[model samples]
Target: MSMLGVAAVIGVTIATFTTCGVGLAHGTGTWCALPLVWFIGFPLAITNALIVGLPLAFLFCKLRLTRWWQFAVTGFICATPVWMELAEPFTSVRWAQFGLYDSLNCFGSGLAGGLAYWWISQKVGIRRGTDEIAP
Candidate 1:
């Protein structure tokens, strides 16, 4: 990779960390939840991006359906399982009433993440397969 590519990566990494850190701080319970947000949260972000985000993007790119709406709906479906399955036990404060709101939260978050990936890929000049190597 070129020096400019390395610099761009460093900048994006810092920006992502700062964005996520500030978001975590503003969401209440900065005391106890902050640590979990860093440890569990960052890992989950990496996991979702790699596991779910990469494949989804590949499918979209392969199918030539890289529209924003495609990203949103694909993201929503990919993330629905995490919210419905993994996040259920934590909604104890108002368990019965939390699903409606948290469901949206989870889906929106996924959509945003997908859009971010697409935007970043555009900004960074990445293309998959043949276009990635061809002039």
Candidate 2:
């Protein structure tokens, strides 16, 4: 896949996960619904990535961060908005809040996402007819 294509996938995935994290964090239900948000979430995720991920990728690249570190960083970066949005003081339940789980999820999601992007891009290679080339 081209960088743009890969970016699209990453963006979408990031958005989806972010939405899930935010939703799970703020939801008051016994259990969170994961599959219900795909329609709206996919586009939102991709758009978010395109809008946010591109600059992030460039920044990471510029900083000369390793791919593994980038994934960790990317996940943390992706979760920031969610964290910020859910920062309102809770008035009811205080046992388990969204912050801890959401933060962890964001970190994990970012690590996985970064690794996937790096792997896919490396596997796809830079030239046409050589997508099979392994990095």
Candidate 3:
């Protein structure tokens, strides 16, 4: 639980920075957008962490599928639906109209977030009963 919270914070921070970086690249108001991005991204990231990530984590544990690549793939898969909803690809007449840049942003964030969570969990050693597994 605490791990999830920490991972969420890290994920949100990465996302906020990514957003600001993109804005800066476009010569937009990057600093002015920082607060808004953090405020909005934090809650959503946390919610996604709980609603989607938690169950997947448990399932991975149960199946002994704790590889780093597996987590990265899971993160990418989880982010896809969220991106679709945000981009409203279904609502658009041309699916190609969906912004590839935004998709990449979300996917990258998710991948980083998953890797962060996996690294934290490994470092902290997931507790199963009295045995600690660091795999």
Q: Largest lDDT belongs to which candidate?
A: 3
Error of 1 at 14 (Å): 15
* Per-residue C-alpha lDDT of model 2 across residues 1-135, encoded as one tens digit per residue: 245335445644664566565665667342434464356434444555556666776665555444555555674577456445544454424325444554454444445555666666556542333234445
Error of 1 at 4 (Å): 20
What ranges in model 3 sit over 4 Å off?
26-32, 89-98, 127-135
Local distance difference test values of all predictions, in order = 0.53, 0.51, 0.69
Where is model 3 poorest over a 10-residue stretch in terms of lDDT?
93-102
Instruction: List TM-scores for all candidates, in order.
Output: 0.58, 0.54, 0.73
Residue 21 alpha-carbon offset, candidate 2, angstroms: 14
Q: Can you write out model 3's per-residue Cα lDDT over 1-135, one digit (the tens) per residue? A: 667667766865776577657756877433534565467656766677788999998897877676788877887787776677777745564335425445665776677778788889888875433355556
Whole-model lDDT, model 3: 0.69
By descending lDDT, how would the candidates be arranged? 3, 1, 2
CA lDDT for candidate 1: 0.53
Deviation (Å) of 22 in candidate 2? 17
Best by TM-score: 3
Q: Candidate 2: minimum summed lDDT over ten consecutive residues — where? A: 125-134
